[model samples]
Target: MGKISYYTEEGLNRLKAELTDLKTKGRAEIARQIAEARDKGDLSENAEYDAAKDAQGLHELKISKLEEVLANARVLDESTIDASQVSVLSKVKIKNKKNGAEVSYTLVSEEEADLKAGRISVGSPIGKGLLGKRVGDVAEIKVPAGVMEFEVVEIAR
Candidate 1:
């Protein structure tokens, strides 16, 4: 069994949509490529055929992985989330202790993480450090650069 991961409604829906697209449109496209390559000539000497076959394998692997993720995914109700502490789906504002720069990030599942969108995976170093921390708490996170200190400024659903 895969480890269960919590997601927001929008994130779960997006994952389902992607899985559907991969199984339908994505599989059809790969099948078409394989057929076209097969029609060219001998399979042994045809690099296109080999490439198409490889692509099909990769595509199927992606589908399988996605299915597993969906199976273990549980949607978290925003209303039920605790606003007092940082956790998955919690929008947290943290201030860098050194520079006093503040940034907001929503903790999400690995599949739902998008740095540009201010969503971060709970598995990330910073996210792990911030988990369960309440406002005014300091989180010491170890990144590739070094250990950085951040103070939890706010937590919201």
Candidate 2:
């Protein structure tokens, strides 16, 4: 119903591919599983059939959600992005105000957030606080642990 905002072109394509997979490959797999289970025994008391039906329901739910995402997805243009401030799709380098430890994070969409890969969702607490911040600005972001402050060291495209 609402827009599915994305940070990069690649991320949008990935979502589309996932949607296609769910519609095609995923559907085929579920159908096969259901058919196999159906062949096992009587429908009323068949545990395998019940389990397969449940799996089908869950798979359909995923497909529905994926379709919604694909319908609303808007891919961001990389060339038009301004690097003067911390914004979505920007690679931001920040320094901890208290500890002075520096780290770099690529701001992305919620679906693309991978902490291990240093990609953070723009809607996240830290990312929300960092948005629109220019170099030398301090972003006071609240986390589950406590409030942490990060100084914007650099913003890159």
Candidate 3:
């Protein structure tokens, strides 16, 4: 079974659109490739046919994985998200305890994480440490480099 993942309405819609495209255009393109390879002749010695078959298997695997993700997805209502403490969908402002550098991030699911956009996955090391923290609370997060401390400045939705 796939793990359940929560997404904002926009994120969910994006995922659905991708899945639809993969099922339609993606499948059609792969079928065309396979047909072209088959027409190239001698199956026993055809490298193109072998490569196309392998690609078809990979394509099907991708479709199955996407279907599982969609089946386990749940859309979260942003307005209903609690901003009192850090949690999924909460936009949190934090200050680095060591250098006093401040940054803000929106906690989202793995699929919706875009670091450039200030969105972080709830499963990330920093996000995990920030979870359930109230304003003025400090969180010590362990990353690949080392442990770092951050102070919660604010939380919003």
The best candidate in terms of TM-score:
3
lDDT of 3 by residue, 5-37 (tens): 999999999999999998899889989988999
Name the 10 consecutive residues with the lowest summed lDDT in model 1: 75-84
The list of candidate 1 runs beyond 4 A from truth reads none
* Model 1: residue 17 alpha-carbon error in angstroms: 0.8
Question: Model 2: per-residue lDDT, tens digit, 1-157?
Answer: 6776774778877888888898899889999998998898789999988988899999999989888877787888877778788789999999999899999999999999999999999999999999999999998889998999999999998
C-alpha lDDT (0 to 100) for residue 135 of candidate 2 = 97
- Cα deviation at 67, candidate 3, in Å, is 0.6
**Counting only residues 3 or more apart in sequence or on different chains, how many pairs clash (N, Cα, C under 3 Å) in candidate 3?**
0
- In model 3, what is the error at residue 96, expressed in angstroms? 0.2
TM-score of model 1 relative to the true fold?
A: 0.95
Candidate 3: which stretches are off by over 4 Å? none
Q: lDDT order of candidates, best first?
A: 1, 3, 2
Better of 1 and 2 by lDDT: 1
Judged by lDDT against the true structure, how good is candidate 1?
A: 0.95
What's every prediction's RMSD, in angstroms? 1.0, 1.1, 0.8
